[model samples]
Target: MAGHSKWANIQHRKGRQDAKRGKIFTKLIKEITVAAKMGGGDASTNPRLRLAIEKAKGQSLPKDNIDNAIKRGTGQLEGVVYEEVRYEGYGIGGAAVMVDCLTDNKTRTVADVRHAFNKNGGNMGAEGSVAFQFKHCGQMIFAPGTDEARLMDAAIEAGAEDVVTNDDGSIEVITPPNDLATVLEGLEAAGFKAEFAEVVQKPLNESVIGGDDAMKMQKLLDALESLDDVQEVYTSAVIDE
Candidate 1:
């Protein structure tokens, strides 16, 4: 299986843990607020907001929390204005790492991210140092038992670009970033529910790492994800399952 697919599966399982659910909610709420602030509070008219809301709903975020977040974004309620930031770095085994953050204080966020990388067997990189190795796209993943033939036909008919069946039997559908909502709706309409779906920075190539290096890489990623300002972490490292 590809590195991203492997990592995604790991994340999918991790996401169900009670300990991580609160942090996941925080990140989703931030995305929702930012998306609403940037594109207006109306999901029907804002693609980013719509996607964020869908993701939040998938995670079972409360309706009141979602409403309040939208209100905050629209200035109906006071809220901190966050700035979006991206940090590129290299993890153990030279794997490319990207950290996406939303923060009111850039200095603190950067310091935390740098510390995580440095202490976890990784090094920070200059902007664009590792971004070139990734592609930005909408990706939807179905579980192992999903009907591949059915999903392929539905995704293609909905204008998806590609369908990949991973070694673990999970299926991934790729689509243009802007077409995510339409494609997701089509898939849902066809009775194909995704286990994981999002627009992501998918690596073009993968680095296989094992043993201590893999463990350290996982630590680096976990540290980054635990930071309050950090929203998402993407890496090219494929570690042993």
Candidate 2:
């Protein structure tokens, strides 16, 4: 799950992933297979695949599993044929939410997603209902107290679209979705590594929901993310973390 304002702290998020490693691995495998399928099996020639592999490695996914997923994607091995699907909805306080999924059964996936929203104080939205509120872009977030000046220079040279320093002092580097890997490599080479980096549906603006509403919003997000077919969940809701 990803949030724009007052996003979960990096360490806290990492801890959550550690607790849900099994589910995380399942999602990562699906991502690797889908990436390889869409962009061939060669990571060196496919930016999406390269990024997917990097993420898998970061999570300690086994080499054999990664290799097998790639082979399955390239049709060298048989695997479930999956299709990509996206669902949009409104959460507590009507904050916009988007869920990205990869599934072999669209009927089951949609039903699960709709059920999640309906049961979690959220309402499912039609296609394009809330899409305009987001920007599909690459995002890299650096911990606070980094050398912003140096990072800015590096980001510019790396072809990043924008560099923003949030009120909390965390830095955000934005790039075209396709340039994520290139920009990430350049930044790392320049001694500015991000704590989190990925292509995502970034909210154009955030809607702050606090107190009871915040808890409800989080529950809604967690419900959607818990779906097996859901690969990612993005929301415009900002909650006290």
Which segments of model 1 are wrong by more than 4 Å? 1-8, 11-13, 16-18
Name the Cα RMSD for model 1. Answer: 1.8
- Model 2 TM-score, all chains together: 0.96
TM-score of every model versus the real structure:
0.94, 0.96
Alpha-carbon local distance difference test for all models: 0.87, 0.89
lDDT of 1: 0.87
RMSD of each: 1.8, 2.3
Can you tell me which runs of candidate 2 are displaced by over 4 Å? Answer: 1-11
The deviation in Å at residue 102 for candidate 2 is 0.2
Residue pairs in steric clash, candidate 2? none
**Candidate with the greatest TM-score versus the true structure:** 2
